[model samples]
Target chain A: MSDVYAARRGLLRDRCAAAGNAAALITRPANVRYLTGASPLGAVLLVGPSEDALFCAGAPTGEADEGRLDEHLRVTVLAGRGGDPAVAAADAASSVRADSLAVEEHHLTVARHRALRSVAPKVRLADLGTAVEQQRLVKDEGEIACLRIAAEIADQALGELLESILVGRTERHLALELERRLVDHGADGPAFPTSVGTGPHSGRSRHRPSDRRVEEGDFLSVCLGANYRGYRCEIGRTFVIGTTPADWQIELYDCVFTAQRAGREALLPGAAYREVDHAARSVLDSAGHAEALAPWTGHGVGLEIDEDPQLAPTAMGKLDACVPVTVEPGVHLPGRGGVRIDDTLVVRPEADGGPELLTITTKELLAL
Target chain B: MSDVYAARRGLLRDRCAAAGNAAALITRPANVRYLTGASPLGAVLLVGPSEDALFCAGAPTGEADEGRLDEHLRVTVLAGRGGDPAVAAADAASSVRADSLAVEEHHLTVARHRALRSVAPKVRLADLGTAVEQQRLVKDEGEIACLRIAAEIADQALGELLESILVGRTERHLALELERRLVDHGADGPAFPTSVGTGPHSGRSRHRPSDRRVEEGDFLSVCLGANYRGYRCEIGRTFVIGTTPADWQIELYDCVFTAQRAGREALLPGAAYREVDHAARSVLDSAGHAEALAPWTGHGVGLEIDEDPQLAPTAMGKLDACVPVTVEPGVHLPGRGGVRIDDTLVVRPEADGGPELLTITTKELLAL
Candidate 1:
């Protein structure tokens, strides 16, 4: 495991050296955790030049990145409180006599960047851009296993919720129950807020759970995910609240389910991101619901709930094998509610089996 | 209610004008919410030489900050997707013939700042610094009311957990249960991640709950807060697991309780922020436990959990009337765990009662 972290750091070092930077400072938490196996609060990873060093404001919590840290990386914990880790990392970079240092300009504030420049005036500063994020776009088998277990936890939670009485319960209560079940099934926490939108609120992406009660014959769309270890996976399902579904509800559900299936089927290695988005979006676009569609059809999900390779019309890039992404598509009629079906799938080559679905829950519209 | 938001924006405009900035763009979410009473995703507030406008990447969710928007502010929702709201606001500022504009440099990234400058080259960009944060230091009556309710909800949640069976439960389960109870008591959600540490893990600041279970004669520390409306309040307490607390546990709890009370008692209008921190910190410092202490003894809590007017040793500021802050003090002995006591209180004049304690949970150490 330590060797894995060392290998990741080696890859980052090669990229930095190629970009004419002797040292790279990773301040973003996810990036820091990627290069080093752990990320303590205000911890920064300084790689290459001489030796890799993890500069931190204080001692590691032992819970976050404890024993998993790479043995090859030097750990520097500051003695005082409220000191800037980025500044400390820059000073460390200066100590190593690095001529140039690369930093994540997208994540660093202008103030922090200026401070870093002021502290280490001799070292030229360059932007590392989204190099680390691009590196994290695809999942290793170990990371995929974490996502797979996360998806399974979410599936079990949602499955148990379906078995219990849900009618007349407020959206907030149902959401809370789902979250509790997620933990009961061994999730570190919810990937994001467990969105339980019912009635007119159904099918909306990122709906805040309200006190609205679940009613018979109303659409109930739930979007939830689980965080296991550090990886995150998302799953969403829509169902009718009563024993019999209304005609419009069934129609909307079928349309969304079909579009979602198309999107999932389009998740092939080397497929253009926009092409995958169009596969699902064209279905809804032809049905006259294009104006109300969300910005993105789906997005890559891994350590962070939302990552790279956005499945949008304007998105650039091609899907690679082992990249995990979510395929969520929905149509919401204003004041009438709608349906959304989502799944977390990993892109795999056709010979290896196309798009191994991590979220195995049945998407067929269920009436309960 | 709309007038309240307008008034806040007017105050900010006056400050900007005094600073020689004819236009100001507020991109920080809390600042945006404070000025316009709405913080739509990717929304930026431009307070300017002309009528103020809010530039949003998409339509408002109409859930959060929905009914509270100031009617006086013009809202410009971008028709298309994937446009930066800050750039749009800067362009709007340029259109209004503003010679100079101020932005929250502490919040904006270097890349984002560069993009804003490129789009609006005519306008000179100035750092807004902490002007908006300073304006939010003292709470109005309405904000105080929200904080009061948030505290009550947290107190209720903690009270209910005390009545349940807690022994042998994993720290994660306890934390999740407390979160559920917060929602049950009508909190929007937990203000921060609920912290539950058992035995050796107890009393550590910001300890991530682990799989540790409670045992006889162990110390258990729990810290949690509630978000009511948008206002947040926090409370923390520690208890003994068995019928009797060992001598050291009892002595440690008493000392922490006394320190917390001293800090609470020191919360008054015109009190130096560090003085309040010293009142509590001195207790632990005198006992030779200074090395294990956290950076800040306490901090202000409001729209965001940790706000300005931080109660720390090196902090510079005077507490004003209507300022809501927390005074949390603890001491953790390695391998033995320890005690922590915390509360949210509002500073008031001596004539009207020194400080109003919002978190009214009893401070006495309880043995379960």
Candidate 2:
């Protein structure tokens, strides 16, 4: 693990040197964790010409979720409270006599940038842009294993929820129960807030669970994920509440299931991101529910629930092997409810048997 | 409620005007929520010379937890995807012909600030500093009422947990059960992650619950909070797991209880923040436990779990009437367990019966 972290730092250093920077500062928590094994609260990683250092405001709490710190990298604990780790990293870069330091402009606030400049007047500050994010687009076998386990945990939670009686229960209670089940299955926590929408609220993305109770003949949609060791995975499914579904419910469910399958089948190495999105989106568009679609059909997932390589029309990128992404597409009819089917899969070449589905929960419309 | 939001925005406008800026941009979510009733995802509030407007990248989902948007303010939803609301707010400020725009430098990222500058080249970008936070230091009666209800909900959750069997249960499960109970009693969610520590993990502030199970003769410290209608309150207590507490456990619990009471008693109008912290620290320090103390004894709680007016040794501020804060002090001995006592209270004038304790849970040590 230490060697893996050191290798990641070495790659980031080489990228920084190519961009004419002697040192690069990473303040984004996920990015910091990707380069170094651990990311303490308010911690920053400075990959420099001389040596790499991890600056933290306080000592690491040794929590399992925070990951283990790399022993090869120097760790510095600030002496006082309320100190900015980014600024401390900048000062350390200056002390190492680095001519230029590249910082993640998308993560550091304007005030902290100013403070860094004031503290190290001789060190030139440059924007590192999304270089680190681009590097994290592809995952190694170790990271994919974590995501696989996370997806399995999410599946077990959703599977257990379906076996229970969901009718007459509030959306809030169902969501809480699923989260508890996830933790019971050994997940670090929910990757994102569990969404359980019933009746008119079903199929809406990221819907906050309300007090509305599940009713017969209503569409019930649940989207949940689990965070295992630091990797996150997502799975969403929509089902009917009663033993028999209405005609409109069956039609909407079949349409979404077909579109989702098209999106999943389009996942391949070297495929354009928008192409995969179009495979699913075109189905909904032909069905005349285009306006109700979310911005993207799917998005890359890893250390962060939402990452780069978004499968949107305007998204620019090509899929690479080992890139894990979600293919979620849904449509909500104003007062009648809707359907959504989502799954987490890793892109692979045809020779390797295509995209590996991490979340193995059944997508067929189930009447619970 | 709409009038309250308008009045808050009006106060912020006046502050900006006094600082020589005709327009101000609030990018911080909590500040935006404070100034305006609603804070949409990725939304920014622009308070200008002509009128106040909210810039949102997407349509508001009308979620109850997101609050209601003030009708008096104009809401402009961006026409396309991937557009930043802050940059749009800056462009709107420039269109209004404001000479300068004050932005929250502590919240806006450097990349976002640069984009704002590029979009509004004529308008000078000035730092808003912590003006909005300063305005939030003293909450109104309505906010206090919300906080009071939140405290009640937290107390209810903690009380229910005490009635359950605890021996041999994992800390993770106990924490999850407490959070589920909070929502069961009508909390939007937990204010922060519930902290449950057993044995060696007890009495540590912000301790991430692990798989450690409760055992007899062990000290079990649990801290949990509830967020009701956006207002948050916290409470913590430590208990002995067996029928009888050892001499050390009894001594530690008494010491922490006394320190917490001292801190609560010091919460009066015109009392210095550090003075309140010292009232608690002096007790533990005299008992030769200074090294085990956390940075601050307590802090204000409002829209955010942790707010301004931190009660720490280096903190500088005076308590004001209607200010809600927590008085939590704990000591953690490495191998042996310790104790912590925490409660939320609101400062009031001496003539008004001194500090009003919102979290009315009994602080007595209980052996379960």
Candidate 3:
């Protein structure tokens, strides 16, 4: 693991040097974790000309949630409270006589950036842009293993919920139960807030759980995932509440299931991100639900729930092998509830079997 | 409620005007929620010379957890996908002919700040500093009422957990169950991640729950809070897992209780923030636990779990009436568990009761 982290930092350093920067500071927690294997609270990683160092605000808590620190890198524990690790990183860069330093401008606040400039006035500050994120776009086998476990945990949690009596339970309670089950199955936590939408609330992306109870004829759409070792995977499914499903509910569920399956099947290496989105989106669009569709039909997920290579109409990118992405497509009617079917899959070349599905829960429209 | 939001915007506008800027852009979620009733996803509030407007990335979801959008403020939904709300806000400010626009430099990323500049080339961008946060230092009665309810919900959840069979349960399970109870007792959600530390993990501030099970002779420390409406409150308590606590446990519990009480008693109007911190910190410091103390003894709480007017040794500023703050003091021993006592209280005048305690959980050393 330490060797992997060191190799990641080495790649980042090469990228920084190619950009004419002697050193680079990574402050975004996810990016820091990607390069250092650990992201302590208020920690910053500096890939430098002399030596790579991880600067933390205080002593690391050695918490399990915060992954193990890379032993190959030098660790500096900054003394005093409320100290900005980025500023300390900048000062260290200056002390090392680095003429230029690159920072993640997208992550650092204006104030922090200004402070870094003030601390190291002689050093030219440059934007690292989304360099680290670009590097993280393709996952190694180790990262994919973590994502696979995360998906398995999510499947287990959702499967357990299906076995229990969900009728008469508020959306909030059901959401909470799913989250508890995720932890019970050895997840660090829910990748994101579990969205349990019942009745009119169903089919909405990222819907906050409410107090509305599940009813006999309502559409119950549940979207949840697990964070296993910092890798996140998402799975959403819609179901009918009672034994008999309404015609509209069945139609909506089928449409969404087809759309989601289309998106999942379209996850091929060398495929344009927008093309995959259109493959799923066109299914719903032709079904006359274009106006109600979410901006993106799918998105990349990793250490963060939402990552780059968004599968949207205007998104500019091509899918690559080993990239984990969630294909989710849904449509909601104003007063009537709707359906959403989502799955996490890894892009794979046709030669290696197309699109490895991580979440294997049956997407059949079940009438509970 | 609309009037309240309008008035808050008016206050911010006046402050921005006084700072020589005709308009201000609030990008921080909590600050946006404070000025505009609702904080939609990727929303930015623009307080302008002509009118206040909220720029959202897309149409508002109208989710209950986001609170109600203020009717008085004009809302603009960006038409395209991947649009930056802050840039849209800057464009709006430029169109209004506002020569200068102030932004929360502490919240806006350097990349975002640059984008705002690029979008509104003529408008001078200035740091709004902590004006909104300073204004939020003294909360209104309505905010305090919400905090009171939040505190009550947290207390209810903690009380319920105390009566449950905690032995042999993992810390993660205990924390999740408490969060479920918080939602069951009418909370938007947990104010922050619930912390349940057992054995050696006890008394640590913001300790992440792990898989450690409760032992008969272990110390159990739980810290949790509830988010009601937009306001948040916090409460923490430590207990012995089984009856017959050791003399060290009793001594540590009493010491922490005394420290927390002292800090609460010091929450009078016009008291310096550091003075209050000292009142609590001194007790622990005198007991030879100085090195193990957390950075701050307490902090103000409202829309966000941790807000302005931090009670720390080097903190500047004086406490004002109606400010809801938490006085939490704890000492974490390296090998053995320790005790932490936390409470949410509003600073008040001496004649009107020095402090109104919102978290009414008993401070007794309970052996569950």
lDDT tens per residue, model 3, B1-368: 77888888888888888889999999999898888878878999999886889988866765423456666778887734558999989998999899999999999999999999999999999999999898898988888889999999999999999999999999999999999999989998999999999999998888888888999989899999999987899999999988899999999998999999899989998899999999999999999998888789999999898998889999998988999999999988988978889999999999996899999989888899
Cα RMSD to native, each candidate?
1.4, 1.8, 1.7
- The TM-score obtained for chain B by all candidates, in the order given, is 0.98, 0.98, 0.98
Model 1: share of real contacts kept = 0.60
The true-versus-predicted C-alpha distance at residue A201 of model 3, in Å, is 1.4
Candidate 2 accuracy as lDDT: 0.91
Sorted on TM-score, best first, the list reads 1, 3, 2
lDDT of each: 0.89, 0.91, 0.90
lDDT of 1 by residue, A281-350 (tens): 9999998889878889999998799999899999999999999999999888888888889899999999
Q: In candidate 3, which residue pairs clash?
A: none
Task: For residue B323, give model 2's deviation from the true position in Å.
Answer: 0.7
User: Over the stretch A72-128, how does candidate 2's per-residue lDDT look in tens digits?
Assistant: 788888733657888889988998889999999998999999999999999999999
Give the TM-score (vs. native) of candidate 2.
Answer: 0.97
The regions of model 1 sitting more than 4 angstroms off are: A62-66, B62-66
Alpha-carbon deviation at A64 in model 2, angstroms: 7.1
Clashing residue pairs for model 1: none
Question: Which ranking of candidates, highest DockQ first?
Answer: 1, 3, 2
lDDT of 2 at A335: 78
For model 1, report DockQ: 0.64
Return the number of clashes found in candidate 2. 0
